[model samples]
Target: MPNAAEILVDTLIAWNVEVVFGLPGDGINGVMEALRKNQDKISFVQVRHEESAAFMACAYAKWTGRLGVCLATSGPGGTHLLTGLYDAKLDQAPVLAITGMQFHDLIETFTQQDVDLTRVFNDVSVYNVQVSDAAHMENVASLACRTALARKGVAHLSIASDIQEQPADAAKRSKRNRPAHTPQDMFAPHCLAEDAELDKAAAILNDARRVAILAGRGAIGAAAELQDTARLLKAPIVKALLGKAVLPDDHPYTTGGIGILGTLPSQQAMETCDAVLIVGSTFPYIEYYPQPGKARGVQIDCDAQRIGLRFPVEAGLVGDAAETLRALNKRLEQKRDGEFLGTAQNSMQKWREMMHQSEDSSAHPLKPQRVARAFGERLAENTILAADSGQNTELAARHVDLGVGQAFGVSGALASMSCGLSYAIAAGIAFPGRPVAAIVGDGGLAMQLGEFSTAVRYGIPLKLLVIKNNMLNQIAWEQMMFLGNPQFGCELQPIDFAKAAEAMGGKGFSIERADDVERVLDQAFAASGPVIIEALVDAYEPMMPPKMPRDYAKNFRKALPQTPNRDLIEENVARQPAKTMMEAGE
Candidate 1:
């Protein structure tokens, strides 16, 4: 007979969870005991905050393409995982958050440590389940990991503390199948010979003189096809925030990411194009699309459910982008000389000029947005960029180059912070020897800074360029825009991140001036181990790079239709300044 905690650990191992990242507590003593005894079976990485633990797990999964696992205790411990899991959900990072509950009998009984774990975690995870009996633990655990991994999302598994201490017959345990890829649709789209579909899609592109390509994160797998499709259609590509860097910024088809905070080119592309092709993206905002009836749409995707999820479509064809684009390319009569794209290309050139001006090192107190641009210039075309939430994400989205074969990992829907280090680690492991770097904010950095150890332990040595703004800059901006006032708990006291890194078994350096950034970054690359380079970036800065906004007034104000329109919204915003919303006004 083995302890229930042992059974759970064994089940996690069987699920192929290579590493566990989290903190320990009284409720999970049994699990901790078992973890100590069976150290080799599953390695544990301790993090400073439960949020960081969750962040690390999400990163590990993203980098490794496996189920990233985390464990925490009851009450506050369980609650701490909420933010990180939400990031995992939004980013589509495959992470598993395992938490301990009080005695099964104590649930909803006014017990001291009891909290509705599933209810609390439901919003943050695609799936959240609580185990009642030992008989079903293995199946549920395996299912949770499999679902998170295969679906590339977050899943939560909670168990009673007392149940973890219960005895289990180790011999009775059974294993379940966990597969990564489903069966592929073998035949190419052209092979189907669907008569009117290809001809119609081809006709639509050929007829439209002014066309736009709206690409999203889903377009990543179809990068080459999308690029070729752009060439065939002569459509300028306007990417979603999550879609940034998929197409090289310098490409003639690249217009930039579109949204409230995006650039003028993206907005103009969406507004002016006569024909718009929605490829592998389900943009959340419909208003960002060509004004109703302004532009006709042709959507190509493998998932039919996503076709008309956001906007009305004149045509929706269910097919893989890579397969569909290749087929569509064959039928597409090369359009008239890139006249429409040429006009847009001129607009893109203006954009390039604006970026250069904004990124000039002359901006004092170094802007993170500028730093990202500068960093981009020095990074390898092969650099793997991993960005955390807040201004860092926005900056990266707007500035990072999609150099030839560069792959970026952002918490697409999850938008979690502190995911950078783990993601960089995972990126390093997934694509070994490629330069992996992450830009994180102070609040986000503090949330899961401990993940640096995982990078160091695994010998990842990923470069970290911390945008130390000492505040929840994103949220603060939201408050500024929506409430017309800044609020409390948005600022943070600076920490010696470099020293902290040394304490945590990694190298740490500080950058005071903007001029020192590139030099320090170069030095960091030469270092032997994982390094944290904290750049004391300017505070109260905008996350999106310095550029003329399509509608600055709209984005800087509360929502037109009033939702939870705050001034700023990004990943990781727990530690804020003590100033009251009232005090911020004066």
Candidate 2:
């Protein structure tokens, strides 16, 4: 029989979908039944929340280099998927969203939680299709997959309730020989002075006292290639946190990701470098980045328009980072006279030392930095770290040393709050068997802590460390820094997270004093289900040493005529641990 649900599943299988993350509901009963019958072909992962389902798909796609698929019922269930979908879209991950719609007539007329799925998702999605009939289901489904994979973003496809129950064609058909779209031809628009621009960029590099490479998320795919280039040029790699995987933190070329919340090395490198190579990332922290006139910039991007759009570019290349690097590396002459590479390597060591010092968790009120680092030490190589926005991301980014197989998930492009729990759920499900931890703020945890119910319902073993400060500390700190004093609206009447977890059938413990943090976390580690370890830290402890106006002014200073000594980084690392150990009374 040609039922719509069978046809949809056939089409999904044809599209090479191996997994679907979703929660079943009445609206999609037919589809659910069909999927259940064919469980051997496609695995349906039952997630607690639709948002986590979507995020899980996104994580799988990002990690496996495949298109992720997520499904949900109508209205609110469908709507909940948006936040995670937006995260996938912004991060350039391929996620195909399937949602069930109510009966056609009931849609706008308000029939039992009916909502306009297409209209709501259109703005947030790269492409959206709402099928009114079952016959064209295969075409629509294929288009949705193609859109998501081709654009590297989110695509939403909605099927009406009635249509899903209709009989489908016996066999699914596909176009094996589809023509690909023509690549953009921007070269014609900017054919002026190509050779001259290359000459200028090369001259800047040759004459530069110090050079630094800034890799954004776009550069993540080409991290190692970029590192090779950086090593050859003797430049430190300053990545954005979204660009976390580009250069391994252990690499001497990595100076740490740059921003206002940047590590000391990133800021220091940006302050002194004469030549900057900008790749893949449209980092919004322009104030922290080198200004247009301050340094010679060479920008590389997939879209030519992005190159030099933010900062003035002395030269720009429009291509994939890996492709561009291959070409750029060809044109460069290595000064291997041991002048640049040696110095940059020495400076990198010093910067890592200083970071270890700052991450020292020895104090009366525990710094989030030390806690995150200690947690990192206890975690496995393949463990997934789910980080929330604001201070959580900052602390995890600066302090967490990722192992070869480890990956950290954060709301980079969307910068969404409360993404921590959802991220953990998806990452945990996608990576199954690997321990997943959510390092979140008290305020951020409250955002989607309701979903902990979902985690408990599924009996997924996930760890959550809540930095409970009894306030929206990041917001309060920002307000204090930018607007004289902290303003209202930052206060959060604290709740006991541990108790809340117990109420929801998960383990939760409320630990206020610093001494009790690790004990609770250790207990949670041993617990079988989702556990919340709430550490009551200061509202804003270790506030990043409060950057002053003078420090800000140094950004505008000219690139120094000499490269920094790498030995300083080694010294910093050597001194930091001993200092932390003494302070920790270890």
TM value for model 2: 0.82
Query: lDDT score, residue 184, model 1?
Result: 21
Model 1: per-residue lDDT, tens digit, 1-586? 6666786787677766667878899878878887887789787766666876776677666555577888899989989877767777766778888888888888899888788889988777877888765655645666776677655678888888877777655324345422222222222223232547777877887888888999886677788888888888788999887677668877778888787446667777887788888887877778778876767778886656677777777677777677777777787777777887887889878766655655664556675656777667767767788888787777776666677777677666656666666567657655556788887778877866667776777777477888887878787666545455534567798888999889989898888777787788778777877788888876745443223233433444333234232322321111111111112222
Best by TM-score: 2
Mind giving the per-residue lDDT tens digits that candidate 2 earns over 247-285?
667777776767755555576677777778888878876
lDDT of each: 0.71, 0.71
Provide the lDDT at 348 for model 2: 60
Question: Count of backbone clashes for each model?
Answer: 17, 16
Judge candidate 2 at residue 357 and give its lDDT.
61
Error of model 1, residue 415, in angstroms: 3.4
Clashes of 1: 17
